[model samples]
Target: MNQNGSEQKHYIDQYLREDRMPHIWCPGCGLGSILHCFLSSLIKSGIDMDKVVVVSGIGCTGRAAGYVKLDSFHTTHGRAIPFATGLKIANPELQVVVFSGDGDLIAIGGNHLIHAARRNIDMTVICVNNFNYGMTGGQLGPTTPLGARTQTSPIGNYERPFSLPYLAAASGAVYVARWTSMHVRRLEQTITEALLKRGFRFIEVIAPCPTTYGRRNRQPTGLDQMRYYRENSIIRHGADPKDVDIDLNGKIIVGKFIDIERPTYSDLLDEVMQRAFGTELPKDDTSKEEATVVGSAPK
Candidate 1:
């Protein structure tokens, strides 16, 4: 509320709930840091808060929708995309963003994820990948590295994890980038790009769940996790996704892997409608007498 009969624009503080100040996340959880970076990016982008809609799925990272004061929708587990899709189609002018956890996006909603990318829908998808399903007590997820230990895999995971960024790029996402919480500046830039891009844009932020995955994997604290990112992560533009791999107890690659322009689903839909209605039908110029003489008498 303001004197000019318009809602005053305060910083993100106005959007946050002070009562929810002490968030429910565990100590050293990277979700808070990622949320901070995202809000910072939104402020830097200068988009009108009212025009931005944040949609989220059910997970620790999905709590982002609750914290942000912007118009938000908290959908069922692994269904953020379809919900956001409807919002975007209904109000194409609004900026739609989807915040999801690694497991939510890659495990249960994996088919929808790829199809959205393939359709080139106009939305930004920010996937916080902490390697395991932190909200469910550290179960193995699609992004968990091979041989990593989780509550469900105390004997070390044997299945290969999905390379999220590469999968998005290969699935036709116009903008695909991978950044860890350590690279806040680059992460912000990538997110800004994704928001501004007109097609499906995917960003994978490698966050740390110190309470579950980190501590169990011997990286006890957030600082230890940051050190791991600093020591093992690579920083370079256009790094090949094939070369980027996280070996068990080995180096982890992080960087902006892909950025390309592509026609969005909305753009293609408009084209289709224009083609269907733009042309006129052939006209009938013959008179009634000519038709009767040609033996095509009227009923």
Candidate 2:
């Protein structure tokens, strides 16, 4: 209650589907914090909430779409990006966001991720990386650090994990950034910035999965991993993504590593249509321009 001693409701309550309340995340899991930051960012972004759509694939983080009170799609495993792509292409005015876990996005949906970035699709992707497949009994995943023990890697994981920022940058994402669930304010700010940007924006959040992943990896609780992030995280804005490789219990370099501009897929498509035919589709008033046809081909 405020000083007036009147009933009050949390701002997030308006954005949440209360019927889906009591989320499914485990104790000490970082999904709650990540979700809060995302919802807060949506408020700070000054976007038309009615125009926003959230898409998710299967995983613990994928449950985010189901809980939010927005136009959302809980898609099949690794198919969130493609579904989001279709939505954007069909209705260019909608703001599409892909929120899912590392296993869903980096493993099964890896191809869609790279191609979406390559195409410079106008959408934002928020990937919560818990370092393992949290929804699947803490199995080894694409982003699980080398030597990290999980259900599948009893001894240690020998494979190298992909550097997400590097992958996004190389694939042509116009904006790429990363932050841990511990960095709530910064994460919220970054998400807001990504929301306002155009063309393939990616933000990776390193969250703790204390229930399944932490118990076996020495981080017995969410607080323990939060402390680890507090002590070991280094903010290095503009650092080369290739140089930022996370290791188990090692230093974490976190910051906005890339921001650039390029024509979005829709923009290029419009140009092609103008070239093929003497007419073009109507554009938004904000981006409207006089049309010119240097040459035309048979439609």
Candidate 3:
């Protein structure tokens, strides 16, 4: 409603928790744009909103779960993947989407991320790579580029950053893609596609942390970062993920790298249960007496 007593509506209102108006992302931060693209993608997917769930770990991007209108969980730092995996296993019908930052997803939670992809969990991961740990005073993170400056590396970082798309592809993610917040339309489309797919899907989104990362990297504003992405990004669909590494002020190869079919964890679990019991386990067997108990393998 407007101040004039007239009704007002925005297309994205339905997907957001209106009560939580005015997000906490700083001025010139790209997290807002990332969230917008994600919600827009949800609308484009034409999926049942009730069946969708959002999970996020502790970081600037983790607030996305609290802002979204869908069922969501703001899990502990670096634990979003394992928590989301539990949700999927408990109810296979739910479409779980993990929205978190590079620091949370790749630093502390890195092991879980790789193993989840290795197991081929049926979930989508939207990793916002802001180069540093934006939520915690812009410290050095696992994905901070070499020679980049952060609070922990005021002179310059000496560590090599992980190429997220390459890592996800190598870890057995069935669908892998990379894009920046500047590529809104393409990003929304890719998210829509990832949402409908069944397997471990990973999308690495390069976003600006203007208040922290940008302040030190010469891209002091989100607009500056967007301009950089506009000028430096190159779209090469089907390119090898291994060749898509990003460097400071270097050409960023952005596109869909891998889209392959693989048996998901749920699929393999069903197969094993069928082989052991001569039938698949009931998905909704809530009662103890009705639930099947495994004793010994059939001879």
Candidate 4:
């Protein structure tokens, strides 16, 4: 390692791709902050870096996979979860993470997201919610607030936004939490907590896109958005997810909304295979049932 100042080495975890320094995020954008927190959390969690796999779909947040110094994947738009699901099912020992944005994960990829969570997949999903499609010129999105104007919602948006915390909770995520970029320590701690948990863990980070989403929504500067987060954020750790919908310039409820133990998708599958085959079925078998067919010996 080069003789660099300790301060310069901050957030430069072995899990970070330092060669990809000076990322493409806009000035005052919050992705860099979130990235730092994620790396910090990963270090604090003390997990083996070699076992980590980061996956992302196409979007601004999707760029995260490219910059992480791990087994990172930059999959097609809206397919990050499915790819991560494949990795997890194939090797139960691997810790998979799907890091993407609202548009990439909860819009076109919405069905996959719900099903993955419903199946209780063991993975960590970090969704950066900037309210609009920040990478695509600030277009209106599924999470864009009602009455908030965007490129597509120039006439003042009327469609209701998805309450992400409620969605994750209802979809069966075992660990669900929400925080803004401004909530640095709390967000990092929450990430660490999620990393240590099993089942479908979800953390929705309310971040600022000052160059796009923020500029269009009256938060002309990142500081302005941070001020809003500081003033409006209410840390109600045990609040019901049903009541956490964000409104236009309304109270923002942020907290750890859900953490419960449940059988993961892999666990249930293993149980079924064990019962049917009189033993655990190997994950590498593609024609698993064919080997167990009538009059056929188990492969």
- Model 2 per-residue lDDT tens digits across residues 164-256: 999999999999999999999999999999999999999999999998889999989999999999999999999999999999899999999
Candidate 1, pairs of clashing residues: none
In terms of TM-score, the best-performing candidate is 3
Q: What is the lDDT ranking, best to worst?
A: 2, 3, 4, 1
Candidate 1: where is the Cα deviation over 4 Å? 1-11, 279-299
Model 4 per-residue lDDT tens digits across residues 56-160: 999999999998888999999899999999999878889898999999999989999999999999999999999998888999999999998898888889998
Q: Which stretches of candidate 3 lie over 4 Å from their true place?
A: 1-7, 280-299
Query: What is candidate 4's CA lDDT for residue 258?
Result: 94
Model 1 lDDT per residue over 1-299, tens place: 53335565446666665445557888877788778778888888888888999999999988888888789988998999999998887567889999989888899889889999999999999999999989889898887888888998998999988888788988998888888888888888888777777889899998888888988898989789988988888776788776776666688777778888888888887677667755342112222345566775544
Q: How close is candidate 4 to the true structure, as a TM-score?
A: 0.91
Clashes of each: 0, 0, 0, 0
**Cα lDDT, model 4, residue 164:** 93
What value does the lDDT take at residue 59 in candidate 4? Answer: 92
lDDT of each: 0.83, 0.92, 0.92, 0.90
Ten consecutive residues with minimal summed lDDT in candidate 3? 286-295
Model 1 — TM-score against the truth?
A: 0.88
How do all the candidates rank in terms of TM-score, highest first?
3, 2, 4, 1
Model 4 residue runs over 4 Å out of place are 1-13, 280-299
Superposition TM-score, candidate 3 onto the true structure: 0.93
